[model samples]
Target: MTAAATTHQHTNCLRCGRKLTSTKSTATGYGPTCTRKVKAAAKAEIVATYKPHLVAKAEELIEQGGIVALRGRNVFQVVASNGVDTYKAARQGCTCAAGLKGKHVCYHRIAAHILSLAA
Candidate 1:
């Protein structure tokens, strides 16, 4: 019997399947061009996929500075409609009802994600 650690080698780009020659590319998995395209597509997806009204609401939330990133924490405080309650939104999940139930994508999570990308 033996205990050993195994290391996996990445020989191709995760994005385009191109052979990885550079150490930086191998470490990151995604090539330089794909990385840029991925970042651009993320912002575009935020605008294109979500409902127009929801996007507007999310933008308005950002404008009000309601989405605050907690220092040293990976969570953001999304201001509630009542202005009293707080919804803690993580990178892709939120504490709001909609987020919990997964019925619809709440504006709180969207606001948090938008702010995260901006930072």
Candidate 2:
């Protein structure tokens, strides 16, 4: 077999580390069940962290011509009426005043979510 074909032979799911037998599972490095679990977990996390008011505010900001830029895989830079704000939606969270205070969700994070969904 060719080198590329040999390298593509994955034997286990990357997330669950379970043995893979199906053609699709080997090719993707994740079994169908594992993929569903991962996707569900991600969706649940987003739902858990979501704040309705913040999301609304973010939508308003976008409607007002705010710009959102991807700084990294999970980080985003949002330029709005207030100013430039950075938000890491994956782990670090938003660096805005509300986020830093640990009291409420920030509009920047919601904006980042909107941008991510659009992408």
Candidate 3:
């Protein structure tokens, strides 16, 4: 067989490196089980380390027109709730009362984090 034909003949699962068995697997280049595992791992990695409350707050901030601004290095300011409240968001923590005590992740910090990810 020609070199191009030989190369095209072998199809391997991208995740497990196993020979592709089914037509669907060959088309996707990943076995169904491996694809599921990969998706699960990705979801777990994103959710496991983050605080769910903070993520929810961040989403809320986005929906409410929260504005995030950089005051200085490692310092951010989040104006939320239609410009009613302004909170300082820093790398160490946030300036909000809840963040001051280190009891939980505050919405300001979460909003700043979300803005950073978007940028």
Candidate 4:
């Protein structure tokens, strides 16, 4: 993807208050480049922390003959089944870099996360 020649204007780094205007490489619409990495890492950490809990719950629900169907933006489908129980999810949009990569959060991930929590 081609970045605009002029960087999007911002007052200050939302996270660390570092000035991003002076930086050559930056994640648009956000604070400094460093803060972007920090934010992404923090988000990933939180998601990773929650993953085990979510997976365990989902597995338990599946084992108990419960089925769940979730829909999101990307239209991607995921099915999880254990003999009698099955859970399915279909998302409607793409979250990868080709789509809304900078957005970080994708509909497919959100839907699956929601289902995992629901489980």
Which candidate's TM-score is highest?
1
> In model 3, how large is the Cα lDDT of residue 11?
73
After superposition, which runs of candidate 4 have C-alpha atoms over 4 Å from their true positions? Answer: 1-8, 23-33, 36-40, 51-119
Candidate 2 wrongly placed segments (more than 4 Å): 1-49, 80-92
Q: Candidate 2's C-alpha lDDT? A: 0.55
lDDT of 2 by residue, 61-119 (tens): 54333433455435655554434343444234676667678676677666556545443
List, residue by residue over 1-119, the lDDT tens digit for candidate 4.
11332333445443334565654323332344443453344345435644555445433432222322333322323323323222233322333432344343333344444333332
Could you give candidate 3's per-residue lDDT for residues 1-119 as a string of tens digits?
23432233327654345798887666555567765663454344434656877666665553333433455324565664445567778646887788889987776766555444333
Q: Could you tell me every candidate's TM-score relative to the true structure? A: 0.59, 0.44, 0.48, 0.24
User: RMSD in angstroms, all models?
Assistant: 14.6, 13.1, 16.6, 15.9
* Model 3: pairs clashing at backbone N, Cα or C within 3 Å: none
Q: How do the candidates rank by lDDT, highest first?
A: 1, 3, 2, 4
Winner on TM-score (2 vs 3): 3
Per-candidate Cα lDDT values, in order, are 0.64, 0.55, 0.56, 0.37
Name the lDDT of candidate 4: 0.37
Rank list by TM-score: 1, 3, 2, 4
Error of 2 at 26 (Å): 44
Clashes of each: 0, 0, 0, 8
